[model samples]
Structures are given as structure tokens and as C-alpha cells.
Target: MELKIDESIIKAYGFTHQNINIQQIGSGHINGTYLLTKLPSNEKFVLQYINTNVFTNPKAIANNIQAVASFLNQQFPTYLFPAPLLTVNGENMATYNGSYWRLSPFVDDTVALDTLSSPKQAYEAAKQFGKLSRLLNGFDSNKLQATIIGFHDLVLRFEQFENALANANTAFKTKAAEEIEAAINYQYILNNYLEIKDVLPDRVMHHDTKISNVLLDQNSYEGVCVIDLDTLMPGKFISDLGDMMRTYLCEFSENETDFSKINIREDYFAAMIEGYLYEMGSILTKKEKEAILFSGKYIIYMQALRFLSDYLNGSVYYPIHYPTQNLDRAKNQLKLLQELVDNEEKLQDIINQSLLKVI
Candidate 1:
């Protein structure tokens, strides 16, 4: 469904179309994206206003995509990267009224999935991310920037949670007592990450691997490419795989208040593992392979920590719809972590079987 948006942003990008149709697009949480269609000509472009508060550096994002697109074009020329289009003055990014804007090619004949209808989508989306990781395995990791520093740094997030807990309101802590205990209980996930974080190789990872970030063929539902590259940076493989597991393995999202609807779907789990390892099995190191089960825990626990931290800090970070939405989200993730832990042995077997299939 298209939303009503003011057409004033068109002028900001040096676009002079007065009668353009502006519709907000995508399911992104951090940025504002719009699909602008100029009437008469019907020319379309994907324009986005970066949330500088989260990224802090827009140039770094543009540079990273440009760098990766350059490498991908040389190594895998046929890949659909869709790098940000340069402004009229040859700048990859445009600045207007202190906000950063980027216009990228609007890929025709593609659909951005809001939900996975089947396990085939789970398999295809995971393969797309895995293939990107595998193709870029040879690129110079130093060329990429940490778009959001510690975006997926589980240890740093845990420390922030500790500080938030220390400074939290007394009544808030009391209200979230059960969630607090669960948060502390999941510290083992953090401990495990600290033990192996240095051993794993840092690849150019799409830090956010939600299904919405992937563009699929309209009819076939096969993944065309990953989009919303603001969070694209150098990070561990688990950031991608773990995010896929956390988002894909469950039919419900983190914001859903009804906890009963958030049960794990093991079919999706097996499909994602089969798909991700299909591309990365040959590329992942033994150490990285060993952390597959922990990948789900790593991101789920990290996100739970973040949501719980914000809840304790009086909902200062994530936007809240109700009085205790963050607390609810935190609880939701903790339940997910518990469910994943209960099935770790079984999921590990799925990973093992997936590795064997790819070999």
C-alpha cells in the first residue's frame, strides 16, 4: 500500500517534477525510503533519507557500497548491485537542509517481500545473502567502514545493558524482574561470543538480513539481490546468518505482543541452513562452521539485551508504541532464545546435514 508523502523532497534532490507521485516504500525501521514516479514520463527512482543519528556517517555508507560495487563488477559483473546514483555534481550522496539523500536505480520487475510465504523463500533469501558473502570473500575487508560501530558487537551491547540496568529506575527494574533474570541468564551467549569472536574471520557482511532487505523476482520469488545497504559493513558471518535465523525461523515478528504466536518453525530453520551453507559451506572456516547453532543465540540474545536495555533506560533508544513495548519485545526475544536453546542439538544436526549436502 502506498502512503501519502509530501513531494517537497523531490526538489531537495534537484528533481523539478511538480506532479510526481510519492509513495513510502519498504519495511525499514531506520530510514525513510520513497518510490517517486514522475507523471507523463513515468520515470522512477528509489530515494532514501539516511538516519544520520544511527549511522553518524553517510559518506562512509556511499563509499562502502561504491567500493563493493566496484569489486563486484570486476569479479562478478552480472551481479545486480544498484549502487547509489551520483548527483548532478558527480557526488554519490546529496545533502539538502542538513539531511543526507541517496537516489538509486529502481529495479523494475522485482518485489520486496514483507513475509516468507514458504520455506523456499527462506532458502532463497538465505542463499542470496550467502552468495553475496561468498562472492565478496576475496575483496579487501579494510576498504569497508563500520557503518554503525558495534552494530552487531554482542559484547558491547551486553555492557550497555549492564550500565542501563545499573542506572535504571527502581520501579522499572521491579516491573521487569522476570525479564531481567532472563537477560542475565542469557549471558552465556555473550561469554561464548567473547571466546570465539577473535577466531572467526570478519567478512563483508550485510549486518541486517531481514527478508524485506531482499528483492525477489516478482513471479518466481527467487532472490534478485539484497537492498537497503546502509547497514552494509565488515562484520562476522553470524550477523547475517543469525539475523536470518532470528527473523526467518519464526513466523511472527519481535513486536508482536502475543507471545503464543511466536513459536519456532523448524522447517524454515532447516531450509535457511540448507540455503546459507549451500553458498558459504565451501567458504566458511571450521571455526565459523562450529558457531552455526550459536548464530541464532548471538543475534537473538543481543537484540533482547538491546530491547531490555532500552526498556530499563525508560525507552530512550527504540521507539515505543505503548508503555512497555520494549519490555514486551525483550520478553518476546528471550522466549525465542529459550526455544532456540531447547532445540540446539536438533538444529545442529540440521546444520551438519546441510554442510554434508553442500559438500
Candidate 2:
């Protein structure tokens, strides 16, 4: 069944759109997001079709988003992101054409950038994202569901790596084993993952901290807010820091098959670490500081294992373009991890300098 959004249903939620226009606006791999324009009032809202197959529990997912929005509404009442509308039945979600859909009041005059075009944008993203962390400080981590088990656990990822090696088909098993052996020691790269608990602060973390999720004001280029809250859950500071850099600090495409062409951008790394420390330094613990550089290497190795595992397993998890695409991605990530390991000292210095500035 094709999913068609009811315009009148939006009206029942007080959007008051006489003439409705829905345009496909996002390229999100999961949920479908649309921009809805009200012709008479000239107001805009976002309509999201929740992919229940992906989420499994649409109500819980919607509830989590509502919880976060409610918490933010209490803390930073002045600033606003989109807020989900409660249906007449008192539920935030409605069944539409056999799928779950939700509506949120859109923020006017704000735009999410496709790329972090400048240093200022990077800085603002850090600041605004830090603000989100601050706003969510006292929330209970246990109250939120994990959504995906071991979503960012380095140890769990190592287990998956072993599974890949054990299950590879005869065609790729030998090469897969060789790749597995190369990354075997990489697991120890995050041996100190627990040590971070001593120095850095913890809170409900935005697990996917890509720069594109940040909404920036067009004129001033200042970050206004972070959108895409689907992956929000409990984690340490490194999860956010590592994922942010994973998305923002690389010069090469994630899928680059030419392993020799992949290189880490020092300037980009320095800028992102500096920006993150500016917002999170004071709240971070001593142990968190020492492990900050390792976070990059640790997360990269974990992801490399994941991609490689998926490749060996015939693309069960992430989407793949070709048969070996997952392997190519793993190679790229492993290459980056190696670079990060080589630059640990320099990256540490960047973190130290950033801390000094923030302090």
C-alpha cells in the first residue's frame, strides 16, 4: 500500500493548512521526511513516515523523541526544534496505510547544511551540540531503550568481527581471515575504553553526531540546533566525538575502493577536536581527556570490523553497492584507523591545547 498523508488530519492537530503541499525533502536511509507547506497561512511543517520495519517499535521510538523534546522544552524553552503532535487519541503516532507516521511543528527560517562549508560552521556545530548535551545532563539514561544492542560498544564489535571470520564462504574466507588477523590487535586499541569513565562526563548521548544534522542559520552561518534524534541514547563522550569526526574530518569518500588514496585531514581533525573541547571540556573528566585520541582509533576499528563482518555475511546489516563494497568500506576505515594510531601523539596535543583554551 502506498502511504499518503492526510491533509485534514494535520488540521486536526492545529496546523490549520487550507491548501496542502508535501514535498519529499530528505535522503535519510531510514525514515521518510517531507516538507509540508500550508498555502493559505504560508506556514511549514515536517511530516515523517516512521519505518516500523526498521524501528520495530514505532510507539517507543515516538515516545523517546517526545521525551527528549519535552525535556528540551523545559530547559531551553526559548529555542525550538520540531515538536511532535499528539493525536486526538493522546498518542503521538498514527497508523497510516499500514505504516506509522508522525507530525512535528517545524522551525521556520532554519536550514540544515549538506556540508560543513567553513570553520565557523564547525565551531557552531560543536557549540550547539554541546548545548544539547548540557540540556540533557540530568536525564535518566536507563529510561531510554538501546534501540540496537551494542550500538557503539567496541567489545561487542570485536565479537562480531570474530563471527565474520568464522562464517566467511570459501571464496572469500582466506582473504577475510587475513583481514581479520590484521585487525586482531586493533581490538586492543580500545583496551582503555573503561578508563574514560573516570575523567569525562556522561549523559544521554546523540550517538550519530554528523555535522549535517546541525541546523545552521543561513545569514550568519551559526548553528541553531541539531536534528535527527533517532539514535539518541546513553553513551560516553567518545561515542559522540568519534562519530562526529568519522563524518566530518575525513577527506576521502567512505566507500573509496582505492585504499592508497584514503588520507586523514590533520586540519579537519584539529578543527573538530578544538570545537568539541570548546563545548565539553569543563564537564569532561581527566580519564576522558587521556582517551580522547584513542576514541578516534577505537571507533574506527569497531566500524571497520562491522563493515567487514557485514561483507563476509553477505550484506545483512548495512546497504552495499556491490559484492565487495562492504569489504572496500572496511579497508578504508581500517586505513583511517591506522592513520589515527600513527598520529596519536599529535592528536593528543590537539586535545590538550583545546582543553587549555576552554579552561
Candidate 3:
């Protein structure tokens, strides 16, 4: 559990070791985050260590972050992103202890997701992300290389899942075979993803759009800034919306293990669409609107399949807490997918209502 940030490296970068205080910050499971505080002046920074196991190329990831930040600085001055603070050599990243680390000024008046208490908060969150999408239209996607190839490819993901199932030696695979088959069937609906991708206005999207990535002002539920810009690239708005819905619409707590406890928040879904379409209603097409529900189902099913495959392949992809952890996760996600399918009509109505407001 020890993070190997050296004191000498801090001093070498012109920040005194005596003044700087670094403490671990609770981010997601993938990467490590540290809230760095400077004494006397009391300046703060977020020093993040890139998860090398997941993001193999540190240089490319740093470059991608730099590109996005540079773009934001030039284009949208009001929206604050995590702008990397360069070192003495004018480099934003530094290699230390067989890992990559970077620093950025810590944004004040910011709160990441604990839980969405009201519909208004959810609506505001969605609206802010829509604004983000509207603002980032027509950026150069060539600059951001896919650090993890086949990340969004549903077909490739299914092949990997099948391989995992075929290779599994455990008895768990026997009981889960039916659920896996159902998930596989749903995978077909997403087969023509490339054909339908044009519906949603494609641009530089925050591919990993979870509520935690947005920093909301304490006083106002309005989203202040979208942080964690590592996944910004050329993807459909549906990818962001799908990921956001996947994370936000779940009623079960993060620690919930039982599949029966899972539920999808329809009101939450409504608020999310309300928030999102508020910013980019004029830009979205009819086809895009029609396919939004499919996007939600596809992404959720994709995650479940991915988790199951990783589990069957000896738990290499995601860190597992228990023997049945991955299986439980897959089941929970499938339940979420089922709920989304059931509420498809209401979800579409929400989108249409939001669109009418914007029009």
C-alpha cells in the first residue's frame, strides 16, 4: 500500500520538501491520487500516478492530458480542467520508482460525487456534461491516441469474453453460463455500432463520464468543472452518456455484492438526460435520440461481460476482493441492464422532453 514518491524528487522540482505535504486521495480503483498541500502559502495540487498496468504508455497518457488542457486553456477560459503544472525541464510528467507521476493545481470550491440526493443535482450534473460536449466540438482527435486499444470495441470485447469462458477451469462457469448467453444475445443489438455512431455528433468526448469526475460547487448544484480528462478523445456523445448513466443510475451502493439489491433510478435517468440535453439539444439528431436507450444497455452489458471474462481469465484485468467478486459484479451489471431495458419507454420520454425544452 506504500506509494514511492521520493522527497528528493520533490525538492529537485523546486518545491521544498519541508513545506509540501502529500496525502493519499480516494479516487477509483485504477489510478492512485494524492492531494499535495504546500505550507506557508497553502497552495495545493493533485499529484496522480498513472496506473501502468492498465495504461501501459505513460508518455502517451501525459501527452494526451497536456493536449486537452492546452485546448481548454485556449478555447474555454471559464471551464476549469485539471491543467498539468510543468516541471523545471518544461515537462508535465516525471518518471519515479518505475511509475509515471504528474502534478496539477488543485481546484478549490469543488466536490466530487458522494451521492446524488435530489433530481435537481442530477439534472445540473447532466446539463454541465452537455455543456462540456458542446464546448469540445471539432477538436483534433488524432492528438489523443487510444492508450488502451479496443477499449470501446464491443465485438472485440465479446471475443475476449468467449475466450475466457472456454478457458475457465472452475465450476462457477457452469452456473453462470445462461446469464452469459443472455448477455451475448444483447451484444448483437450493438453489432451495427459503427453504422449508428454518426447519429450522435462525434467530437472529443470524455469517454469516462462518471459523476465523480465532475466537481460541483458546494453552494450550487451546478457542475464547476470536469476533472480526470485522461479519456478525452474522438467518441460519440453516447459513450459519455452511457458511462454516466451506467455509474449514476445504479441504486445499489458501491459496496453492494448481492445482485438482488440492484435497481435503476428512472428519476435519476430523467434528471441525467435533462442535464445533458440542456447543453447540446440543438446538435443531436433524431436517430441519436432513438438510439440512446440502446447505448445504455450496450455499455452496461459490455462491462458485465468484461468483468466476467477477466474473472474467468484469473482476475487479471480488475482487482478482485473475493473469489466470487467478479461474478457478483457481472450479475449486478446485468441486473442494471435488465432494469434499463424495462424502463426504455420512460427514458425515451425524458430525452424528448429535454429536447423540447432546448428547442
* TM per prediction: 0.95, 0.90, 0.93
Model 3, 206-294: lDDT tens digits are 77877788888878767887778677667766787888788888766534787677888778888888778778777777787777777
Q: Tens digits of per-residue lDDT for model 1 on 131-229?
A: 999999999788898988888998799899999999998999999999999899878888899999999998999988999988889999888998888
- The 0-to-1 C-alpha lDDT of every candidate, in the order given, reads 0.88, 0.74, 0.76
Better model by TM-score: candidate 1 vs candidate 3: 1
lDDT of 2 by residue, 76-181 (tens): 7886656677877777876755677777777766778766666677777777777777667777776777665688887788778778778778777665665677
**Which of candidates 1 and 2 is the stronger one according to lDDT?**
1
Residue 287 shift from truth in candidate 1, angstroms: 0.7
Stretches of candidate 3 exceeding 4 Å from the true structure: 192-195, 198-201, 253-255
**Highest TM-score among the candidates is held by which one?**
1
- The TM-score of candidate 2 is 0.90
Model 1: residue 117 alpha-carbon error in angstroms: 1.9
TM-score of 3: 0.93
Better of 2 and 3 by lDDT: 3
Q: Tell me model 1's lDDT, rounded to 2 decimals.
A: 0.88
